[model samples]
Target: MSAIDVRALSSVPVEPWRNGGGVTQTLATHGTEWRVSVAQVERDGPYSRFDSIARVSFLLRGKGVTLRHRASVIRLAPLTAVEYDGGTEWDATLVDGPVTALNIMTAAGRYRTTVNPIVVATIVPPGCAAIVIALDSACRYSEPDIGTDGSIQPGQFMIVISVDRPLRVEPAHHGAAPPLIVTIEPVPARTPDSNF
Candidate 1:
């Protein structure tokens, strides 16, 4: 995998949900097993279900959303990532209004996903495959290997392949918030003979 895979916000096409509750822009997907996308919750309603999948979601914008899963009420704020079982029954209540979120879902026992907030301008996590999403403002990112540079605006993101190279992320201007980077690494796949 290359050190950088850039996906512009304008290039990502919007796909509506079957229930018409909201829309999503898919960034990357590995067949039906795993996917990374940005979703907008336009209404306060029940969330879609994906059995046997695990999801890690980060609140990118808007006021907030509280997800009710099983007996837990999880409040998601900006730049915070929350993991939940996709098979669980969950509903979302918008605190202020509509919200935008970065979602990463993986097949159970096949892959593990982590979404972390990037608070400073520095090198990304060492040796980890990840995606960096610009949350508040435009971000200028440069890769040393490819000798390439690009920018992703708010609501835009890019994929970083399995290259442990350093990347410099700079906000378009001062006082702009740092980006939220989501790292999706493959875990040991579970087979019939593999024990937990």
Candidate 2:
């Protein structure tokens, strides 16, 4: 099992040369075969230029934003995740106010990610990578027998074991407030000779 605190993620300044926009990245990897980055969008402008990349953005703070992709426009609110192909032409507009969003961009065909809100106790199937991003400090997670236990505070996250066996996860006892968990899973790999 591995853990990553969202607050501990280092910030990389957005480069204007790459695109006519302002964005900050907390995690970024540009390997020869794969490209992935988790970023925070502080300003709205033209989207990044990467023909074969997939992007997932979740609003973390402030008002939501409306993303215009080709002829499709999607409104994104806090905790809401919006995904699209990077090659598509897209534009964004601040809706309520300045927004802070969590973004994950990866090589188009190499990988894919899904973002969803988790509440209540649940079990994670094997061969999956689970990322729980806590929205409230009152949230907690525990796995019996497997010995996985911890609490997720605001701006913090945890990743359960990467395995092919199912794992259990229980929410800590909190009278009222429900914890929000975000799970990220990489798409299953294909055969060696398969075209990505």
Point to the candidate with the largest TM-score. Answer: 1
Off by over 4 Å in 2: 1-40, 109-112, 173-180, 186-196
Model 1 ranges with Cα > 4 A deviation:
1-3, 121-127, 138-156, 164-173, 189-196
Supply the global lDDT for candidate 1: 0.77
Cα lDDT of all candidates, in order? 0.77, 0.59
Question: What TM-score does structure 1 among the candidates reach?
Answer: 0.79
Residue-level lDDT tens digits of model 1 in 1-196:
2556766677888999888889999888767868888899999888899999998888878988988977888788877778888888789899889998888888877776777655556565455566888757677777666586777777677777564666666566656777767776677656799767
- At residue 175, what lDDT does model 1 achieve? 66
Query: Model 2 residue 82 lDDT?
Result: 77
At residue 97, candidate 1 shows an lDDT of 90
**Number of backbone clashes in candidate 1:** 0
Specify the poorest-scoring 10-residue window by lDDT in model 1.
119-128
Candidate 2 structure quality by residue, lDDT tens digits, 100-171: 676767667665566655556677665555566555544555555567666666545555435345555555
